[model samples]
Target: MSEWRIYQGVGKPHDGIDRLPAPPPWRDFGNGEGEMTPFDRDMPAQGRHRLPHAAAYQADESTVEAVNTALYLRRPLLVTGDPGVGKSTLADAVASELKLGAVLRWPVNSKTTLRDGLYRYDSLGRLEEAGVAQRGARQDEQPTPASLGRYISLGPLGTSLAPFALPRVLLIDEIDKSDIDLPNDLLDVFEEGGFEIPELARAADVSEPVMIRPADGGEEVTVRRGMVRCHAFPFVVLTSNGEREFPPAFLRRCVRLQLPAVSEDEMRLRAIVRAHLPGADEQAEEIIELFMQRAATGELATDQLLNAVYLMSRTVKEGAPGLDGVARLVLQHLNVTAPAE
Candidate 1:
């Protein structure tokens, strides 16, 4: 709802096909032909994103629907779940479905700050320039705009706000790992599409004033007012490991979804097969079933199942594995002896 003022381009606003540049030969901006191309454009056609057919995830249709809605609304998705339950995978799923782009992951930690997530303003470079300008300047001359702005670098959060037709998906992984106030700070930035580059704002420009774009990308567009407006609202997905609770104010604005630890049956070979694991062997099923039953007592995590499958696959690939091989698979891959009663 907040608005940021933007200055007009030095040239006239681009129009029609001429305004649109000739797309790179390889990329598909969605308007082209039958097959999907990888090329990203200034403006991409917005549409519904299809999710991957993972049975474990699909079992919870509400969760999927919540995520789909978040992507459509361009709001933050809060995922709360046990560790190793594939909370982070949701972001990947959304990115894959929309063919939007890889998730711009912002892993949260205790020390993570708003500025850390936003772009870094080159403090040292700015200091060095100030020194150079001071030494070169005549007594009457004052510091110039060029001396102040070059050292500025935008951070991940700020970069995510960069203007584009297709908004990039931002995965704020494990918000619970950081301090409680982190979410509030993030909310402020999300409400405003862009943040000001303090260094650049000090300079006076007739045509363009504020520089805005992702940190990694080597371009900046001028933004006006105190806020940045989004052309395409970013698909912001925030995951939590369930170590703590969030404030009500923050919770009120977000659509929260919880991912449960996958059931033991969900990890079995039959389950895996149903989930689209092709060429599953009978031997694999027996071993997986054994592990799943033992793990039901809240012992081994589901991640071990993936390891077991890989081992089973390798053994089958290299002829029938003996007892020693199976033991090795259980011990080395699963990282536990037979589950304790």
Candidate 2:
């Protein structure tokens, strides 16, 4: 069980500046094909988690190329656009394309700390040990990595840096929600390819820790000091809603990609639908188009269109009404409460 602690302190004023990593002299080997070598074969699969393939929805050829660049380069892809413009989906799509595990999401917020993004040490277990020792109960504990591992579970940010051939996808969602320092803080890990866990590092010198993994139906991945080395530098994707400006130093480390709104011709929307629902009929496409147009006018959420299509299809399969029913189903899926009649 995880417990969250809220820390209170006098808030400091924003200086609007922080130290950032110097850009590595990256050589543009952008060959005509831009093919990248696969991750090392011998690398362990500790932090390399894969995502569900069907969820990946690529907008076009350019989008695929952009994602490939970020993945091969192992650099942060800064995706900016209006809300619901699939900024976050880019990471998911990449993970799915590569068959990497579920996208590790770090939803940024004003109060989110660097430690929160990295890893947190569990103090409860430590306190329990202190209590046991205070009563003068002498006990010999096994040096299993599992016993020393609970304090060192990596957060999404730290997990992204795990050393493995198959890299994980990390979506830093809505980074604009954070203060200016967040991006700068992230630069080090992005460049260095990993972060150090002080707790695990300290314990590692004592004994070779064991990693406790789920027993197929197990619930947790309990890891010891040397049991896992997450060498897989994550294909990091950071998204913004364009709420705030970023310093140049932070931007230099990442490749910036801007996604425009869905076109009126409905090219991207149609493509997304086809990718998501290959066998969807004409009625489903029409309903999805309607939802997409409606969404385009307001807070255009692409996921809502997907939801609408699924709901409409289910309704039709159950032998419900036609276009009107489909529209109603789309609206219902979007949770757009019926307007005052």
Candidate 3:
């Protein structure tokens, strides 16, 4: 029933996520917890969000259902929406509300690769260190497992896979901008819930766990036997701008979500304004009307109204020049230029 939803999307931090039921058997992996680092305590929860604490992300019932479904199934959420439509904020909202650690963001680009998201090996650096050690005398002194592991740094995707006490929130932003092959490349990792580090696997000492740094900038995590497995599948959120179509095989593994434009909901828009400025209800209403009117036929985003309400309204109320000009300039369509009358 609806009571089983793990993420309520209420903008209030709670531990309800801890009560999530077992993941599907097919998605299960090793149950070992990630080695905790001293910095783990310092990891920022939802309070560090750019959105105001009042409501970092205003989630309607539909959004709540999509997110909760993703959480329950232990599947990656593939969210598609217009730019600035709060696609990325969904990750932060879930993390903040469920007391998940800071959102791990992997912003993809055309040049991004699967390895770029998983981990980066400093092969050149390792080779350089080996040369230095050989020349300095010490029997060629091949770098120890500890030293070699230090050369490998886990990216956001890699960090999210580490077996941890709780599920980490990963936001793979704008995945549609990635290279065509990137989506297909992710299929294996999603199915396996882990990846292998060949460098460590083939090393002289393959028995010991190697410690590597996580993309979150926390202390190194131990990858036992060159494998990074998850105790709990991370809450992975992959965002898209509807720019490209993904392969069918890749799409089949994800929970898809279509985000409505912010202007479509007047109450949500007002909540966003009031979250930033507690007493801006009147300003919010006025700007909301104007924003919706232009947004009806244009590509104005929600933040434009936030800007107009916070800046233009604040200025006008303080006895400055009227904000008509300011609002006009701030709320312009994304793809057009206004006439300079």
Model 2: how large is the Cα RMSD against the reference? 12.5
Model 3: which ten-residue window has the lowest total lDDT? 38-47
Residues 254-336, candidate 3: write the lDDT tens digits. 99999988888888888777776778886677678888887877787777887788775577655554456656678888856
**Each candidate's lDDT (Cα)?**
0.55, 0.57, 0.80
Q: Lowest lDDT 10-mer window, candidate 1? A: 1-10
**What lDDT does model 2 reach?**
0.57
lDDT of 3: 0.80
- The C-alpha local distance difference test score for the whole of candidate 1 amounts to 0.55
Q: State the lDDT at 188 in candidate 2.
A: 64
TM-scores for every candidate against the unseen true structure: 0.70, 0.67, 0.91
- Deviation from native of the Cα of residue 143 in model 1, angstroms: 6.3
Q: Clash pairs of candidate 1?
A: 5-224, 27-39, 118-155, 119-154, 119-155, 159-214, 194-228
Count clashes in each candidate, considering only residues at least 3 apart in sequence or on different chains: 7, 17, 2
lDDT of 1 by residue, 27-145 (tens): 22223212211223221122222233221332245565676556444567898976656677666555554455545668889999988887666677766766776788844654444
Q: Model 1: how far is 211 from its true place, Å?
A: 4.9
For candidate 3, the TM-score is 0.91
Q: How many backbone clashes does candidate 2 have?
A: 17
Arranged by TM-score, best first:
3, 1, 2
